[model samples]
Target: MSYELKSAGALSGGTCCYAGSRLPVRGPKRDLDSPYIAFLGGTEVFGRFVKTPLSDVSESLLKMPCVNFAGVNAGLDTFASDQALQSVARSSEISVLQLLGAQNISNRYYRVHPRRNDRFLQAQPPLKELFPEVDYTEFHFNKHLLSSLQARSEERFAEVRRHLQEVWITRMQEVITTLEGRVLMLWVRYDLKGSAAFNHEPVLVDRSMVSALLGSTMGLVEVDVATAGIEGDFDGMIMGELDFPAAQHMLGPKEHARIGCALAEKLQGLI
Candidate 1:
């Protein structure tokens, strides 16, 4: 794979909205009246610091409209719970759903902000029951809470992992069911996990977890960015100096190009 940065600068995008939908999506918005593809997921799909997200690149390559309804720090619940968003997704000819981390959604263990799935709201009774010795009130983010739980006790943390994984599978199936179109599930694994397993991108989810959803989806496209050594070491990304730290972990322009081409190829075949 080629590793090259296309361009780097500040992003200037218009906001988008659909009828009866109040979700804030990145734009210059596309005309939904035409046949289009909908890209839905979390931060990467939002293309936080990258200028041309993979959705745009795919649009250019396929000569099709790809609406980006992705939100920053969003999880499965972000779209699964949004009626207006689901309506738009269902209307699309095809929907590309990115694989998100399991920890960001609500479950028997905890509740998260409806739109911002990354923000940990409050721990449920079962979570408190599982970690009775610890206080969940100290947490603000799901990843931080999970990291702490793992550090506290690996054996105990295993139950939480299993729960999140199970919930993710069920949530994905439900979301796919509502998407009412040719759905292609995108799996972007940037790196192999280190000691901090929950801290990884798409945390607490593995290939098998996403693979299981394949039976429900039209297909799956797996991009292993770590193999190219471009996961955290990417460059040519556009962002202000303050956002650089977080952007560093994201895919850069070249990475996005590679990803866009991969996705476009699959989508082209389906069309």
Candidate 2:
């Protein structure tokens, strides 16, 4: 179970851009001439410091090509806004959509970069009006903006959270509809806060919100990374000094394996 950790920069697959897609995705890009399954989402789907992602693991078990279209720090909006990437994913046999956090996407209060959903574009009038006393220029990331807003006032932060949750549901549905095929939903989290909890991964998304979107998906594969006991387990991951902080928060090989197996099980008869 003990594997040597290497530098994150040493990973083999570099990102590549498809002809029509605007965003660069994790590479070892597949030839689209043949049928293949597409796995879509953010950092976890991209596998970060982990060598083999769930997409690769599932490919080995299913005996088919699984194209990983995820990017580091990517989120739902990254795909939701990309018509080209959506076209590429729509053509796949099925697309595995990772249920990333709600805060990364654009809402009434703020805007995120279309390609990199984690990047905060600019706060809208609503946000400026809500947090009139706070200087918006200081925020360059969605999490930073959200955290600052929360720190300002919990009562006001609830309003922002509610707006994000609503927008997330609508945006997810649009993405699912845009994909227009067997779209499997994957939920990998370190906690089950019962309600929309910010401290948990898939930040600000709760069971009820997922339930609202469930009918649109092929099915849902929910994994509690902590319950599976992979929260603090960082063995098998390769990272350098800069990669350490993020790597620590990311799920490792064992966790990805468990997720891959669960996803493959849900994917059994579909593909």
Candidate 3:
């Protein structure tokens, strides 16, 4: 389970574009003037640790230029605020947007950093009033703050969950509407898991929730790669000695290839 440690610099080959983006994106820099496919999502879409991500593999399979606009720990708010990234997505013939965890987004109760959606910026009055004794300022990330809140009182945390889901749907709708081309919703999950519980990421949102959020014109592509075949194969896929603990859970090269093929097949039908 050892991978050739390739830093972001090495994989990107010292060529990254930041023209309309807050962060540097993976690139040889494809021409935006011509036809291309845009891939938008969180860390998985960015293909952290893995040498080849879905965008690169899909580009080879479909014979089209693919732009990777995904940001690590990105949420709907990240896309909603970035006009430059939005323009790139609008210009593409088709855009594949990964279904990121709803928890990373901001809601009426709290706010997240615009660029790094996972970082907890501040708590709104409602959240403060709910847990007046808890010092929210001590927290740095959304997951940690929410986990602590839930531990204090499940009833109060229920309200937080409700607000997050509502905001997630609203922000997602707003983001999807701005895209000009055919947008395909790509749901790439480890597996179909349990209900949304406290102390865990909001990785699984209800299908009905997603269906209601997206417009009728959009397409849905669900890829669950938690099968026995690929579940234990992470040898060369994950980058070793990473600071982030979450990098260990990322999908390997085999899963990325599978997802790429599935995306290619789905795109063929749409195009």
Candidate 4:
């Protein structure tokens, strides 16, 4: 069976609505010797909008039991606070830490309200002010608002950005340091290559903080499939092979299959 796709109107459980089936974690069913692999990141890691998940690929390729811990609309803050990260720490033999873009840092504060704010974020008012226009009725991390704030007050934004960056880096370091086994840093994102397919703007991934955090401790694998140029039967960001009602999430099914294959190959090399 395919992974189920949950839309905006569906039950959200206080999280963003993204696609992917709720599959049974492979760890419990497999033997104890089965290597544990944990998938980490936001919706992209969850295979949002992609019919088949990356976990499916990993499982098929490496024959290691894999559990996908990616949460919808999850930012660094969410990952730090969520049960998934803890699960990764306690359960996995290896982790694929997929660091998403910088905008998620803004989401850390914008999505949650003051009453629900974590102490670290509550301490900074100006950072909260960055997303002032967001309507909190049904809370959403207003990316555009935060982007506008950055555009308006470059200096102040930089200060807050630095704090947020540090938080993410610190939390990631904590996870990596405490992990019992191998940790692979997987940098995943939408197509940022060519003339911006389907309006995808090129993003420059600043890996300075990530580099410092790894410091020869973690294995790095970059899958720049967005620019790898795999054309599909249909036209879209990834080829039109993904079974998506909307193409907001990831490469289609064929692309996801390829991603799975690639991930498995890399993981096999590590194993």
- Per-candidate count of clashing residue pairs (backbone under 3 Å): 0, 0, 0, 3
What are the per-residue Cα lDDT tens digits for candidate 3 across 1-271?
5556555345553335545577556565667887988898877778766678888889899898878888777777888888888888888888898877777787778889997888999998999999998998899988778878888998998888887877777777777888853689888766423342432233536687778856643688877765222365455553435622445456667778888888998898876
lDDT for model 4: 0.52
Q: What is the C-alpha lDDT of each candidate?
A: 0.80, 0.82, 0.74, 0.52
Give each prediction's root-mean-square deviation over alpha carbons: 3.4, 3.0, 3.1, 7.3
Predicted structure 1: lDDT: 0.80
lDDT of 4 by residue, 115-221 (tens): 12221222134545765553434324334444555666878667656766666676667666655436788765555333421223112235687687666345776
Question: Candidate 2, residues 1-271: lDDT per residue as tens digits?
Answer: 3334566566666788875786778887789889999899898888887778888899889888889999888888988888888888899999999998999998889989887888898889988888899888888888878888898899999899898999999999999999883799998887532343246888888999999988887899998885223355566666675766566667788888889989888888787
Worst 10 residues of 4 by lDDT: 114-123
Which portions of model 4 miss their true places by more than 4 Å?
1-35, 83-85, 105-123, 128-139, 191-205, 227-245
TM-score of each: 0.90, 0.91, 0.88, 0.65
Cα-based lDDT at residue 169, candidate 1: 94
Cα deviation of 166 in candidate 4 (Å)? Answer: 2.6
The weakest ten consecutive residues by lDDT in model 3 span 192-201
Instruction: Write one digit per residue (lDDT tens) for candidate 1, span 1-271.
Output: 2223323334656456665666667777677899889999887888776678889999999999988998878789988889998988889988999999898999998999998899999988888888999887789998889889988999999999898899999999999989853689998876534466454577778878887888877999888764223355445455554655556567677777888999999999886
Of the two candidates 2 and 4, the one with more favorable lDDT, higher being better, is: 2
Window of ten residues with lowest summed lDDT in model 2: 190-199
